[model samples]
Every structure is written in structure tokens, then in C-alpha cells.
Target: MEQLLASDALSDSGKIMLGGAVVGLIFGYCAQQSRFCLRSACIEFWGGQLGPKLAVWLAVFGTALLATQALLANGGLNPQDVRQLATVGSLSGAIVGGLLFGVGMILARGCASRLLVLSATGNARALIAGLVVTVAAQASLSGVLSPLREALNRLWVVGPSTRDMAQHLPDGTGLALGVGCVALAGALAWRNRVAVRTTATAAGVGLAVGLGWAFTAALSRVSFEPVTVGSVTFTGPSADTLMALIVRPDVVPSFGIGLVPGVFAGSLAATLVHREFRLQGFDAGTGTVRYLVGAVLMGFGGMAAGGCAVGAGVTGGSVLSLTAWVALLSMWIGAGAAGLLLERAEAIGRRETAQL
Candidate 1:
């Protein structure tokens, strides 16, 4: 039953389970404390007065860049062949998908990444979002929507896989580009340095996360049951993880396969130890409608865009995929649109109410 779970060093299945546990614990603990939420970063920076959100995101962006580049240069591992980070540049899909997801996130009170963090804190609405995300994600992967997704992807397919984009550039050039991007991110974070240390810490934690996944990915190849691996994001991965938990028991949880549950467990444990586990309940109002509707849109957008910001932007982008870059840009643009739309809706509603 546990045959495929062994660590790469030894084909011993027990080691696999142990490896997963250790990785998962670290991931969960840091994520919880740091409150790493990609959606929150975008939304808060744009809508709220939170300055650290961008800093936190940029810090991780830089760290992942330096680490991934160094790893590849030193012959650590190749990120492209991993199917989890497929490179398919569809500009329209990303912008459109991100807009839908962004609006959904606004309604749900979080993006895919934020949902996970909030869920760890016991938010009921997040739990609902998670449930919908998982079911719908599965449907996209292999259920009802799988065929359609595949068909559309093929139809709109414009370029090589994301991983292949990295190959187009020299290693040094790639490394430099990543570093420059991170520097820019660091500059952004500098402004908020005195404000949200938690957000800054989040950046470091996100790096740890990227490394953890990379190792798990490498181990999967040399280990007993090889598993495809990439950065763990809450949106699509939430649904994917749920499906894995249900099926992997009769099946097997590979090294990379186990990290996600580890992420949630990590967060849960942090909540418990820190005495921060808070029960959450949702209110019945337009808020409810917003969350539900947003969740559905997020589900569709996450699938359509291929992954969330953390998934497509950070993980896939690190490898220097053109598709990832395109997706990332498109997402931010869409998110901008969502922000404007929300403002307009509010203004219109207030006007109508005042007239009444």
C-alpha cells in the first residue's frame, strides 16, 4: 500500500511518509504565521490601505527567482519537464480568467491563496469556497469540464509549454532577469518595511515554500512513486488536493502529492499552537451572493488561466516561461478592471439608494 512513498535516498516507503510529514509541517507552520495570501496581496494593495501586501509578494518573488536560478545552474533540477507547470501562453485566457477570478475573490473576501490562509483561521465562507474550488477543479481536470478545457486549450494554443520558454534564454540571462525583477520587488517592499513585518516575513516564508516543493519534486523523480510537483497555491490546488486525499488512500500519495495536505496541516498546527484558531461564520446578505458567485467564477478562471497567481505567476514564472509572464500580466490587468468595476457598482448602488 505504501510502496511508492519511499524517499529518493532509499526506496524505503516509510521514508516517503516521513519526508512528506516534515515538509508539510514546515510549510503549514510558516504559511500560517506569515499569512501568505497572493490574492490578499493584490486586492489589499489595490483596494485597501495595506502597503505591505505588495512587499510581501515581491520578496517571495525575488527569493524564488534567485533560488530557482541557482538550483538550475548548479545542476539541481529542471523545472520545465514537470507537467504541473505547463507553459501555454494564452493572453486572452489569462486576462479574462483573472478578471473573473478577481471579481470572485472580492466577493469571497479572498483570492485562492487568501482562502487557504483564512480557512486555516476557520472562516466558514472560505471553507465553502474551498469546497466549490475542489469539486469544480476536479471536473476540469478529468470530470465534466476536462474535455472542454482540453479542446479549448488546444484550439487556443499559441506557443510552446511554459517550461520551454526558459530554455530560449541563456541560464545567466534568465538568472539576471529574475534577480532584476526581485530587486524591483524589493524596492516596492522597502516602502512598507516599517509597516507590516508580517507581510515581509511572508515573503521569506514563500521562498521556503518554493524550495520545499522543488525538493519534493526532485525526490519524486528518484523516489519510489514519482510525482509531478510545483508551488502549492490555494485556488486550483485546493480542489486538486481534496481529490488526491480521497483517491490517494486506495492509491498512493507521492512526495509532491503529500505537500499540499502538509500545507493545510502546517497552517492548522500553527493556529492551534498559537491559540489563533478562530471559528468563522458567514453572514446572509449580498455578501453571500458575492462569495458564491465569485467562487464559481474563480473556479472557472483558475482553470481557464491554468493556475492562480501563485501557481502561474510565481512557480511557472520562475522558470522564465513566456506564458507565465503573459498570464501574470494579464491577471494584474484583469484584477485592475475588477477593482474599477467594484467601485462603479458601489457608486451606482449608492446613487440609486439616495434617489429612492
Candidate 2:
């Protein structure tokens, strides 16, 4: 990496963007192949059917945790330099925003990353929903909705000292936590009889997360200009990518800017190779308004929370960010609640139809 950066072939920012693209490609391919999705995982958990969906999610999460912690333990990466730990965070935002994001993902039938993958596979509905999410996210970031997001963020704040979970834990406890999660995930996967190929792909997703961290951290260390050290995340990247396309055509290349296209390309390649590419649109069973509303909520909620499911949940959680963990738990709770409400509503509709 040092050797490559020393060469004048590309600018530092360009190289960072390329690294991001590589990580995003791996993430996209693995996520697509494994069908890794938090929304599915949440539903499976809440529905009391810990099947392949939940197993896949666990595999991704556990592996990500283990790999990231291993990197930190070995001094391959510095936790203090990372944004999730280095800066102040909002507990209130994590709770409220996570809940909103969870409910939104449920309504949209997918989270930000899932929607992007689906869009690449020619899912028109997902494509539209993703656009809406980007628009809403942009609005929350700097437009009208920014005020509301700011207000919520101010409700409860924590400093860098408290934000980093590693600071409070006993020495090596982070590594132990990672190991325990991996063991649990392995056991669950075995119990569920998840396929070996599926498990491998899921692990690949986790690998991508680790690689993302390593790439950025390494780049930041060597770069003359300041570079943010981050891993795989979709919400902020999606919004940034969209804005670059429409608002700032000449925007300088960044990691997030490259990540969006990389994921799309990887997903497209996977779907094409597997013969899974199919054009899909909205049907009567899938209402448009629900998806639109969900996209809006996800946009605002993700911004408010500082990241999306894969963003804060897997990436941030892997690094042991307090707010990220809180956000992840809140997401689960919100998703479970939303799922139950949806089920009841469907049941009521069925009964009413029968009576009529």
C-alpha cells in the first residue's frame, strides 16, 4: 500500500476511492450470494423461525466482529482514529433514528444496502425506493429535514471517551466478545443446516467489512491530506453519490463516492453470472405508498442515527461503538414491533374480507 501510494499514478483521494470500490465489490458480491439482510434476520428472529436468514445474518455479524477486533488487537488498525469512536455521538439519535430506520426498512422490504443490491438485479421497485431514500437522506443532511435531525441529535450526547466501548472493557475483552459471537453464530448455522457455500459467502461479507476498515486506516496513515477512516456503509454514501451525480458533477472522488457504484457493479455481475437477473416492478400486493414512505423514513432515520443497518450495525458495532450498539439493538426492537403490527393488520384485513 505504501509503495502504491508513493507512485504518482493516482492522487491519494483517487487511491482511497479505488480501495473503497474494491471493498464495496467484495461486500456486494458476498451480500448478494449469501442473501445477507438485517431486515430478513430481524423478521426471522421475531417470527420465531431462526432459519437460514437468521443464520446468514449471524454468520456475517460474528465474522465481522471477529475480524475487526483481530485487526485492532494486532495493531493493524487504530480504533481511536475511527470516526465512530473519535467523535461525539448522540444516544437519543441512535434510539429514535434506529427505530425509524428499522420500521422503514421493514416497510420498504429492504434496508439501504439490500435495496442497492436488488436494484442491480433489475428490481425497478427497489431502484425507485433507493432513489427516494437518497433524496430523503440528502434532505435530512442539509435540506429542510436537517433541522429536525439536529434537534434529535441534541437530545442526548456523549463524548469520545464514553463512545468507545473498548475504553470501558477489560483488556482483551473485545477480542473475547468477538470470539464468543463467532462461536454462537457457528452453532446456530450448524443447527439451522445452513449450506457451506452460503456460510462461506456470508464470511466473505464480514471479510469485506474488515478489509474496508484496514484499507481506509492504512490510507489515512500515509496520505498527506486528511482522509476519513471508515468501512462499508450505504446511507451516507448513497446520498453523497446521488448528490455528486446531480448537484456536484465535478465533485472530487472519495471512498463513499466510489463505493456506491462498486456495490452496484458487483451485484450486477453476481446476478448475471447466477442467472438471477430479472426485471421486477410493483404489484398489487406491494403498495407503492408504503415503499415511498419507508424510503423517506430510512433516509431521515439513517442520517439522524449517523449510519444505516450495515453502516452502524455491522461496521460500527464491529468496532464496539456504544452508540452503534444501541442503534443496532433499537433497530431490532423497532423492526420486531413493526413486523407484529403489519401481521395484525394483514390478519384484520383477511377477516374483514371474509366477513364481507
Candidate 3:
């Protein structure tokens, strides 16, 4: 469909941006309605309830895998052209950085995508966290923290060809992974449906993610100018959007750029329709401190990992990328550990209060 649009009156960039915005809108609406958060999913998984949110996430990720791989099989997208982030240093980065990102997400009470949705619905804390994440991301990428990033790269970065999943896997592996994962996730989600509305919302979110990949892949194939062959991932795009706003006027609007704002717009619209829109802020200084630190850690950690939860976990993992799998697993472990720590602390505090 996007290939057919190549000759349309709109420029290639415009088409790309349009596709991104539409996908973002769909995702935002679904996420807001479903309360989809990867951190929450990890915590819930740890708690032993296959929560609706986790089911939704698996379904969403699996949907992306199936959709994207189908495109690759049909030659609609080139695996070579896909954004591959595997490197020698990535192993350490994904584990260490993913842990940091997971912990920060717990502190902030949301990941990058969830924060954007929260900000749209007039959550002041989320707004502040978003701003901090944007700045911290900039600092890590090119500002003060670049040296630290460079040091890590020099010390731990692996050769590019070492962990490339596509190269090592056989011809039919990508297809098998995608199909099997999606089918299994969808079946489990269906069996566990607690509410019809939540189930529908989860399915919608999954479809939106798949469509996002399809849209980008199609555009990349047809565009004459350089187009990023990627789908929905928030960290780099959030940082890039911030930089574009403040310093770089020359930066052209890409799919990620359009997608970020579209998420806000879509979430806002959904909240209004659902009557869930309300101004919210921190109730305590402790929360404020936690969010501040979390934002900083997330900014640096996300960049180090080469992606955030959604970026590496869903989009990259769709193609069975090794770096993404490692990062995703690391994030799960990190979030699980953080959740346990928090729970233990809360339990101790309760005991202390009872004794007092």
C-alpha cells in the first residue's frame, strides 16, 4: 500500500510521517485504555498472575513479530535494511543498561511510552519525568556523558557480526519464531480474558504494533530518499524530537518524530472520550525524588542499551534479534528484582508502623 503511495502528490517524508502518526494514535489509544506497561507486566508476572496487561504485551510483541516477518518473507522489507543494533559491547550494555532502565521505570511509575500518555492526560509528574528523560538522553548521546558512553563502547562493545540472529539462524527460523510466538500469545490471552473490553484493547494494541512495522517497511521500500526502516520505538525518537525543538532546526521530521506527538494526541483524545482526563501531580517529595532519579537513569540506560523496552523488546525482538532478546530478558529480571525490593520495603514499613 505504501509502495503505491510513492507516486502520490505527498512527498516520501510526508507519507512516512503520516503513517507514523496513524500508528502512534492507534497505539496511544489502546495503551491508555489497556494500561499497557512492560514494567507492570514484569511485576505481575513475578507475582504469579498472568495479568491482562502482560498478556496484552505478549500479544502485542508477538503480533509485531508475525506481521514484520511476513513482510520480510514477501520481500516487502529487507532484513539487511532493517535497523540492526547488535554489537560486541551490546551484551554488557543491554544487561547493565536494561537493568538501569527497568529500575528507573519502576521509580518513574512508567516507561517512556507510558510517560508520554500520562503527560498527555495532564499528569504533571509524568510531564516532568518526560522532560528529564529528554534532557538526560541528550546528555548521554552527545553532551556531558558522551565520554562515559564512549568508554563503555570501547571496553565492552562486541564486533557487529558476532551476535546477529538473522545470520546464525536458518532460513525459516524468523518465520517460525514469529508465527509460533504470536499464535501462542494470542491463545493464552484469549484463554485468560477477564473482561471483554480489556481483551479487545489488548488485541487492538497488538494489531497497531504490527501495522506500525508494516507501514514503515512499506515506506522504506518505496521512498527515494533515505527512510529509516523501523517501527514504533520511543527513546531515540523522544531524544531526537527534543533536540529538534531546541537546537537543530535542520532536523527533518521522520516517522519517529511524528509518532511521538501522535501518541500524546491520541492519548489525550482517548482520555477525553473516556472521561479519565484529570490534572495529576506528586503527592510527596519522595515520589518527586524517585521520578527525577528514574528519568536520569532511563535516559542514560536507554541510550546505552541502544533501545528502550518497547524498542528492543518488541520491535527488535519481532525479527528475533539476539541483542533485543538479551535486553528484553535483562529488563524483565531487573523489573522483577526491583518489584521484589519495593515489596519487601513496603512490608517492613508496615511492620514498623504496627509495632509503633
For all candidates, what are the clash counts? Answer: 6, 0, 5
Q: Which candidate is the best by TM-score?
A: 2
For residue 268, model 3's alpha carbon misses the true position, in angstroms, by 1.3
Instruction: Give the per-residue lDDT digits (tens) of candidate 3, residues 64-154.
Output: 7777777777887676666653335367777777888888898888888889989989899999998898888889889998788666645
The TM-score between candidate 3 and the true structure equals 0.91
lDDT of candidates 1 onward, in order: 0.64, 0.91, 0.79
What is the per-residue lDDT of model 2 for residues 147-184, given as tens digits with 9 covering 90 to 100?
A: 99999999999999999999999988877877776777
Task: lDDT winner between 2 and 3, please give it.
Answer: 2
Model 1 lDDT per residue over 1-356, tens place: 12334324555344554455565566567667766666666776667555666666666777676776677677666655555445445655665666666666666666666576567778788878867766776777678977766665565455564336665665587678767766766666666663455655555565664675556556656654544555555555566567666776653544444555666677888888889988878766547777777777777777766777666677666766565666677666666667778889999999999999
Poorest lDDT segment (10 consecutive residues) of candidate 2: 1-10
Off by over 4 Å in 2: 1-7
Indicate which candidate wins on lDDT.
2
lDDT of 3: 0.79
| Candidate 3 Cα errors over 4 Å, as ranges | 1-4, 85-89, 249-251
